[model samples]
Target: MDWERFARQMATMAHDLLEQDSVVGTLERIVRSATELVHGCDAAGILLMDGGRVRTLAATEPMVDASDRLQERLQEGPCFDAARLRDGERVYRIENMTVLQQRWPAYAPSARELGIGSMMGFLLFTENENLGALNLYSRLPGRFTETSETAAWVLASHAAVALSSARSHAQMTESVATRHVIGEAMGILMAGHHIAEDTAFNMLRRHSQDRNVKLREVAREVVELGALPRPEQPSRQ
Candidate 1:
């Protein structure tokens, strides 16, 4: 298979998904595109790292999520190993789960019971960070060959970049919102105290230190309370 053509198609799909207004819509598109790109694969799934645990970002079938959850629970499998190692562009394929039992004794029987005869997993990374894995499961042995693995890798890399962009956008949006809230709180403090802006800021800092609270939490309470308590006066000498 010519990877150039596959790359072009995956890029187009990713671009279209990125244009969508919601992350859920984008993930749905990613899994659908991935399943179409790989041959002999009955299902496809994308795993994304969230707070140190991998979650099912999207999947072509519910069974795929179950299989992934098993791996997540077992904490040992091709996908987990690939992500931990940051093996971008790497593919691991096993012909039978029973043979894999020796290496992954916990994962093999459950995977086989789930009707997974062969498995191929591709690691997706962004720059230095390991994002997660794109997995393809097949019910027939020797289902994924070298050519299929390469095609899947091309699709997975583009998907990884798109997913990373979405996550970055979400973080930036949250940060801006937090800043807005803090600014509003500061304005409230300045207006209520009839004090200079710098003084109001210092009061907030002092209160945060004295109360053992976060600056943002203090700001939130000040905004809600509408007036801060008077600071205690030091005793006269």
Candidate 2:
């Protein structure tokens, strides 16, 4: 392996990751990088556990999605375990997907049928939390080596940090936007009802609870409609 060339490519990928403006963009870039930088990786994807259900993201090809679905259905696979963060295990590899194994008897044959000859999974994690798993797939047996794993580990490290940053930025942006919209709604209510700011906020909060709606949604209704919607009164018998 050309160590110097690999290092330069990794440097470029790290820069590109941070340049992504959105979480989705960052994920897409990460998967693409896996296919490009990870030796023998023909397909790649990110698998996230949402309430114990698998959510496949940024799949590089149809094979990746198919493999993730197989793992989700069987409830056992390297990627599944990686995303679950079982026992602090950070990496898993399968050099021969065609062979039935005790670790994943159901997944091995199904994955082979899906044209996967080898596989690798790295848990994407930062100091604060575990994000998910970055999965790599190859169609040829024994495609991955120690060098491939090393390169993939480096990529996963950068990917985790980039993913966390993107999510944080997105959340911060959404929070700021929500506050601005809610403030506008409060101003509208204060003027329409001749109430103080605190009263307006309390009215919004109460309406949100009474209507079984989010506070942001309730505030948005006030802003869009120019006044808060009147609560429905009980009908006379």
Candidate 3:
């Protein structure tokens, strides 16, 4: 592949991913581009890890989905290592998993049985956090080369920064909405009870804690009901 042409294609993809309104849409475009742009990549996917749980954000093929779940269930594979940032490795390229029988044990033989010949994974992360792994799979042995690995790594890096930005934006939006709802509920309390803002907020918090409900839930209830519900009586065991 012409490096110049590839770079131009990547530039366009970067613009699209950044401009995407939703995180899922951005990730789906990224995964699809990997299969089309990366040399020797027969399929592509994104693996996301939250806490200890793993999920596939996007996959170009069902094979990619199966592979991701296999890695998750067995707790092994290049994707897992790259996503988890274990051993401080940002990328993992496997030309042949058969040669890594001892290194991967269960995952190696299992991947071979699934018809995976070679694969690569790169860590998707930003300065503040690690998002996950961007993965590519091939059906032929020794499919990935240094050039392809380098290209995939660059793509993954761009994806990581975009993912981080999108997530931050989403969190900020949710926080703002929550604050708006809480403020509305507080205003309702103040108008009904003639209490100060601080006092109204304190009452809401006490009600939330006493009822073992989320503050947002309590606020929503107040906004809908125009008053807090009576506290539940303790059950006699």
Candidate 2 residue pairs that clash: none
Model 3 ranges off by over 4 Å: 50-52, 98-100, 126-131
Pairwise lDDT winner, candidates 1 and 3: 3
**lDDT comparing candidate 1 with the true structure:** 0.75
Between prediction 1 and prediction 3, the one with superior TM-score is: 3
lDDT of 3 by residue, 117-149 (tens): 999988886333434889999998898999999
Model 1 steric clash total: 0
Q: Rank the candidate models, highest TM-score first.
A: 2, 3, 1
Model 3 / residue 229 / CA error / Å: 2.6
Clash count list over all predictions? 0, 0, 0
Which number leads on lDDT? 2
Q: What is the lDDT of residue 144 in candidate 2?
A: 98
Best by TM-score: 2
Report the candidate with higher TM-score, 2 versus 3.
2
Per-residue accuracy of model 2 over 125-155 as CA lDDT, tens digit each: 5334434799999999999999999999999
Give the Å shift of residue 92 in candidate 2: 0.7
Give Cα-based local distance difference scores for all models: 0.75, 0.90, 0.86
lDDT of 1 by residue, 16-121 (tens): 8788656667677777886777777788887765435778878989878888788778887766666665344376667677674566788877888888888877
